[model samples]
Target chain A: MRETDFIGGFAKGLKVIEAFDEAKPRLTISDVSKETGLDRATARRCLLTLAELGYAAYDGKFFQLTPKILRLGHAYLSATPLPRLVQPYLDQLSDKVGQSASASVLDGTEIVYVARAAQKRVMSINLMPGSRLPAYCASMGRVLLAALPEAEARAILEASDRRANTPFTKTDPDVLMEEFARVRRQGFAVIDQELEIGLCSIALPLENARGRVVAALNIGAPAAHAAAGEMVERYLPAMREVQAALRQVLA
Target chain B: MRETDFIGGFAKGLKVIEAFDEAKPRLTISDVSKETGLDRATARRCLLTLAELGYAAYDGKFFQLTPKILRLGHAYLSATPLPRLVQPYLDQLSDKVGQSASASVLDGTEIVYVARAAQKRVMSINLMPGSRLPAYCASMGRVLLAALPEAEARAILEASDRRANTPFTKTDPDVLMEEFARVRRQGFAVIDQELEIGLCSIALPLENARGRVVAALNIGAPAAHAAAGEMVERYLPAMREVQAALRQVLA
Candidate 1:
């Protein structure tokens, strides 16, 4: 974290690329500068550098990312063992429960999906690998939070600007603390329509060879079809079974 | 390609990440320096910067990429339109043919997979989003190459390291030129165990609204069940139908 050890230009270049999103797929130089808080000349240089490397394309006016950018993500997935090791278990859990199953790890204050197996669509948003959801309301997020030390979890919660995403979302720190304690005691978390209406999910922490929680696995379904108690009764055991098998592979 | 426009530090950082692959997932500082041809001091700085940014983790001895690195790829996929627009067509094609279907765009001398749908496993390698393959030997690669200008195609071919991956692979430039011409005339490319034994595939070019060959789509099946002629006879019409529908969407 020392200033001398960091490459400031490399980080700034990445920030410029990350400025483009679904809302702003193509952007002008001024837009990039405003999005990244960089000067116009700095932004223009980053865009041109990306274009020169074939990672971005300039179509006369606006700059957009090219498919070549996918290689950065491909490199991570191909080298990482966590996603590959967790995929088969997710597939089996999805098949057994007839729902969508996913594995996610905490990144910053959000949970980034690493692997997924879908049987049916249950959410308004498409939950694929690299999809991220808020740690305050997601079941996988809560389970991951529960696995962390109390002080660390509290620090993350304090840092996040919690809001009521739905009628059932718990935005209060005290309520979330109580929920985290319950999840810690039970070894799992069940979120009942906290993220989206009619979207119910149950999540269990996945432990590594050293018995340290590394990620969380979850199954999502419609609330009308699966109540919280029913989810705990039906899905929890299967998730635990997969978690046990996954531990052996991780070891 | 101007010197002032290029950012050497950013490019070198990415090269350090790309140096870690399936062959060597965890690397020491010396390994990274050797792989990327950077000095030990420079490599150490980049690795430390990556670790500080939470994109990498150093476990005492070796450095490894973290899942957070996927955010870079996610940014590209979320901002780009091609992969999302092509997913449904790939899924329908996979469902219809009972095989794996993928869409890829040519990047340099390689083809990078952008979207995919799998009904069953068909090859020794896992073909998923973010996967890369040698363009000279892949069916999708051939279809994409055929769509380019003849001079441009020849330049790419010349730049590639042509190798006989299998006994049936056509590595000769003259023979490959003839094959490319045939594919251009026929509007599709079918390769019979050229990339790998028992792997047969047929591919069609996907055109954007500007009539540019933006990507290529292909269905892969084992040679035992689907012969090159059988694939063309049974799957070509269906692939063409999807391609026609996709062209409208891209437009």
Candidate 2:
């Protein structure tokens, strides 16, 4: 492709930022090259450029994203209307559901947290507005995935190379497809310790007035506190309430 | 700047996004051009590009930011380490301070909220992770400004066309300089009814490993709740504790 015709270096830089996630927060130059399919030199240039721009930091051998990098995500959040509208509701949901709540939007192949509220002293990793997780394994990702067109969802599932991140993670592509079908039928999705060993999450879609899934909101807690039946019985009503509240404001 | 230099376009687009604040969330092309000095046609293009990228929405005549713009802020919050490290502490401070707490970083002439925790049913504006306010007027901004070198701080003061945002806003550069000096001596700042009518805020700098003030953390509340003695007697200790926690995690 012609250089200008393709997504430009700025886009590529953004993609490189995306390549770093919970599982791969720090990466070597060769790891980035292999992950992003860029030449090692290109990856190095990108890393150096990112460092110069105050987005990446080097600790002798490994490159890690810096807090300055949060500015990009901050820029998006400050300029967007969704997180502002959804956060208070998520906060209230956390109180009502007695668990942590989060809203994530699909960014390429991942689900990035746009808004989140957590109960104090939770077991899972602390996720913030800019945190990203694999879309194929999390409840929020599954909600967005189930909302996507079948072919597109299938493409992501296939390209994702679903890893059994935990024992509960659904790794088989066919199983994921079936799960998507079930989620679509139920209008929500749940993960039982799929993302982390003792963490569970349940998610529902946040659609605009047009009924397009613009984001996914979910609540997570330890598997003991968020048992599948208990989540369905207790949290589902609150989640639906948030979805309705969000629709009113977002619409 | 060359047309090939997308940097200028990017900068202009950022300005367009920045032009919208809590007070002005929607503007016409002419309004944006007048506000940003980019002319109508250029402003239109930027708005259109933003719309195409799902960062903005336009109703032919009036343009407003889209919820999708949250991704920009989300990108930063997820990648940045400082705010993530500071958040739980802010949550604790919210309870200790008996009001809302926010952590902000300087973005050009603005202070972007990277993290916030508000008491329930306190205010209408839900300050999420990416909200931006003019740095010159915010208590958080004063803490940051107080931390700057005298020459650089004076230069910014001279360049700033201090507008009277509220009856309580200090628009005089000389008075603001004295105020900055006082803040520097005391190592904190309290702003009363300046940014908004009922809102009062107190802020302190968050220094990095290099002892540079990289961010500011503040508590805000209605004037009635955050009286001067209460801030000194109750909130300061909590703020200091949060600052200590922030240094432990972020540094």
Candidate 3:
């Protein structure tokens, strides 16, 4: 982790890739620089490199990522066993519960979805594998953070770009701290429209045989039909069964 | 696209990311060097940078990609509208057809799955977003290739790592050229046990409003129950309906 070992251009290239999101899919060099905080020259070089490598395409003014960029994520999904291992369980759980079930692991201030099984014609957010949600707001994110040491969890919370995503979102760090404690005490976390309106989700930390938290599992449904407390009363037992079952197999 | 404009280090970093797969997940500097054809010093520096950036984990000797690597793919899926636009259609089509449906776009010699909907307890391939299949053997691959000009398609076939994944796989370049012509004439493609033993699939080009083939759509079922011809007979009409409707909406 020495400073000299870092490849600044490579890191900048990755940051440039992340700078294109849902709100802005096409970006110019100056737009990328503004989004990623890199100099315009550096951003142009990275964007040009991406285009030269076939990961992106530049139409005179703006650079947009192509499907080639998925190859990068494909490497991770193909290499890792977590998604394949949890997929069957996610499928079975989602079918039985008639909702969407997913597995995700914590990464800094976000949770990245690894496996997902969505039931037909129910939920609307349409999260697939490789989707990401902010750690401060998602149910899976809260459960994963609750598994960490209090100080480390607090630091991640402090580092998060905290903002109110919905009217129900708890944006205060102190309020979020208490929610973490509640999750730790209850052995699961629940979010009622904190991420988006009409979405209610409940999550539990999926621990390995050695009791190390490897990922978090959750099932989401529409809040109109399944309230936060109702989700707990109805789905928590089934989710706990899957959690306990996963503990025996996950290494 | 100038060679001087290309950042070699950044390209090498992407190659390093691709070097990890199911058979070899945790790799050392020498293993990566061997896999990517980069020298040991260069690979070591790239690995260290990835570790520092939290994309990889280095436990003294081996460098393993963490789930954080998925953020790279997440950026693409979130930014692109194709997957979101196709999911609802995939859901309805798969449900009506009682099989699995997917959409993909061609990238180099591969077809990367962009969106997928699996009917309950039917498909075994379990292709989610970011999954890749060889463009030579897949039905969707052939349809995508057929949409290209003959010389461009032939060039791609020559560049492909042609191998008999199954005994039924057409490995000869000349034979595949004929198949591409057939696909172009018939307006669709079908594969029976080419990619895998028990899988059968049919694909049609998904043209946009301007009649440009932007992606391929397909439905896959067990080869035993639904032969390749039967799949076309049963599901082709519904798939064509979706394709025609999507043409009006997809601009």
Candidate 4:
């Protein structure tokens, strides 16, 4: 073991960052220590380093993160090949389909909105970049699941404690598995009012140059406005065209 | 001096990350060493640490960043009070104005787009959440510039050797100083075809509950479509309302 080459402090710093989550945006040193399983002294030192780097800020007794830390995400999004290349297409798709469209990649089991285009005065949900939702409940997540190897996808579904977040949410793994199979067979996914009431989404896979499903493009609208037939008739061709254009641009 | 308390490996590891810039997204190990002012061996050790933590990835001989590093930005944006509070208002303002809108904060002498309501069917520029543009030419930059202390603002203006990226761009410092004066007098900024042709923006200050100008809200549109009078008439009220709403939410 290359003990001399180990960088424990960097790991500690990242762990400190990971300890702060959606539920716990602000944390005390004790909270961080408990969350990261690090000692109080180690946690404090990591926080101090993060603060010095302008990543974390202190509010007298409580510690909160700063926007300067957004550089990391900005760095990745600006540098990434998929989001930038796919965003224009998503925009065009949104306009053509008369609905809000988004592109996202799976981050663990959750789908993160990387790029989004929405109609003016549309649905109340303010979808934008960097927003996160449970992957098991989203149309984009289902497309990603359909793209994955069967065993891996099954493992994720088995481990997931799916929530009935809304009245129509799919809480049963067996049922979700059947949905995944349908998605794979149809080469697309449709989730109707599953995550939120009155919302429906249709997702199509976007393959990179290597023909791997690196991301998913989705269009969402109210069920009343977005009839299933309309999505297939007006949106499918353009969505496929955008995917092909993405492959060309990336190629 | 608590030299022993500080982790050199960790500090060095972070320095490697700090070395990346908008100009330099990918770097070789030697480039990292030069940028961080570290010896090659030390840099290599730090890179290994970062790679192990999934923050950095090595692409053959060159080292690049990965999406896992988005955790850093997500942590900050999720925790920060300003962006979280301002985002919904920005969306509402975009809907009301029937145009794209954005909010950015100062980073050194450049303006970074922190939140945006990008429009469908518009030619997607390189501007994303982390993207940066020079402070001298952008409407948002001018609003931010007008807000700064005279000495600090003058220092930035004096040090900047502005480039005329487009025919309408104001490069001369004297001319920019006059523009700044106009913006300060009007309590708003309008940039016409400065950074890019056919692009125009109008920006106004967004004060917090304490009335400190923490950020600026800007509406961007194609110059052909965005008349100055119409923007003021249709967008100004919404912009003002959002500004008020942002302060209330944050408070």
Q: Which candidate achieves the best lDDT against the true structure?
A: 3
Which residue pairs in model 4 clash with each other? none
Model 2 Cα lDDT, one tens digit per residue, B1-251: 12332334445565677677545667898888998899887777777776666566778877876544545545445556766678778878887756888898875566778777666545456566666676778899888888887777767777776777789899787788888899999989988777887777889999876677879999887877766556766688888877776665666
Worst 10 residues of 2 chain B by lDDT: B1-10
* lDDT string, candidate 2, A175-198, tens digits: 998999999999999888888888
Assess the local accuracy of residue B58 in candidate 2 as a C-alpha lDDT between 0 and 100. 76
Model 3 chain B: weakest 10-residue lDDT segment is B118-127
* Each model's lDDT: 0.87, 0.75, 0.90, 0.77
- On the 0 to 100 scale, the lDDT of residue B107 in model 1 is 88
If the candidates were sorted by their TM-score against the true structure, best first, what order would they fall in?
3, 1, 4, 2
Model 4 spans with C-alpha error above 4 angstroms:
A1-3, A120-125, A158-161, A227-230, B1-8, B18-27, B120-124, B158-161, B171-178, B227-234
Candidate 1 stretches greater than 4 Å from native:
A161-163, A224-227, B161-163
User: lDDT tens string, model 3, A148-175?
Assistant: 9999999999999988888999878889
lDDT tens readout by residue for model 4, A182-243: 99898888887888877788898888788988889888878789765566666778888888
Tens digit per residue, CA lDDT, model 3, B1-251: 56777778899999999999988889999999999999998999999999999899999999999988888887888888888888889888988988889999999999999999877555455788888889999999999999999999999999999989889999788999999999999889999989888888999999998999999999988888798779888999999999998898788
Clashing pairs in 1: none
Give the clash count for each candidate. 0, 11, 0, 0
DockQ, all models: 0.66, 0.23, 0.81, 0.50
Rate residue A131 of model 3 by lDDT: 81
Q: Per-residue lDDT for B1-251 in model 1, tens only?
A: 57987877788887887888877889999999999999998898889888888889999779998887888888887887888899888878888888888999998888988888765466776666778898889999999888888888888899998989899999877788888999999999999999999999999999976788889999999998899889999899999999889889996
